[model samples]
Target: MEKREVVVSITDNGPGISEDIQSRIFDPFFTTKPIGKGTGLGMSISYQIVTEVHNGSIQCISQPNQGTTFNIKLPQKYNRVIPQ
Candidate 1:
């Protein structure tokens, strides 16, 4: 079967994430926010939903003071039976 891919990106103008913490952004329970401000599960859950549930991928690109961007890629075609 032929497969198609889709790419989606989100960009922001706020202060960018540091390189040191970029790798851990998708880790469960990881957060850079102050206590009570965040639970840090957002990215982690997003990662799982894309990569695990949809067989897709996610990435982040950023530089200090240059803002951040999130890139998500998903297959437009999947080898699974659809419910009718």
Candidate 2:
């Protein structure tokens, strides 16, 4: 069987996320924003979409004041061909 892989990355220049909380960023309702500012489901939903729906993987890399980056990898395989 032949398989293809796709990689994507997203980066931000704002105040980077801390190391202590980086692990829980994908958890449901986990946010560092002020009250009534965020719902905290964004990362959780994204994690589900990539890992569960697409059978892919997601990860985050960040430092206190440097920045943050999200790396995503997805499998690209087709079992049949379609006429174009």
For every candidate, C-alpha RMSD to the true structure in Å: 3.7, 2.6
List candidate 2 stretches off by more than 4 Å. 1-3, 78-84
lDDT for model 2: 0.92
Highest-lDDT candidate: 1
Check candidate 1 and list the clashing pairs. none
Candidate 1 weakest lDDT stretch, 10 residues: 75-84
lDDT of 1 by residue, 7-75 (tens): 999999999999988989999999999999999999999999999999999999999999999999999
* Candidate 2 local lDDT, residue 56: 98
Q: How do the residues 1-84 of candidate 2 rate in per-residue lDDT, one tens digit apiece?
A: 667778999999978988889989999999999999999999999999999999999999999888999999999776566779
Alpha-carbon TM-score of each model against the true structure: 0.85, 0.83
In terms of TM-score, which candidate is strongest? Answer: 1
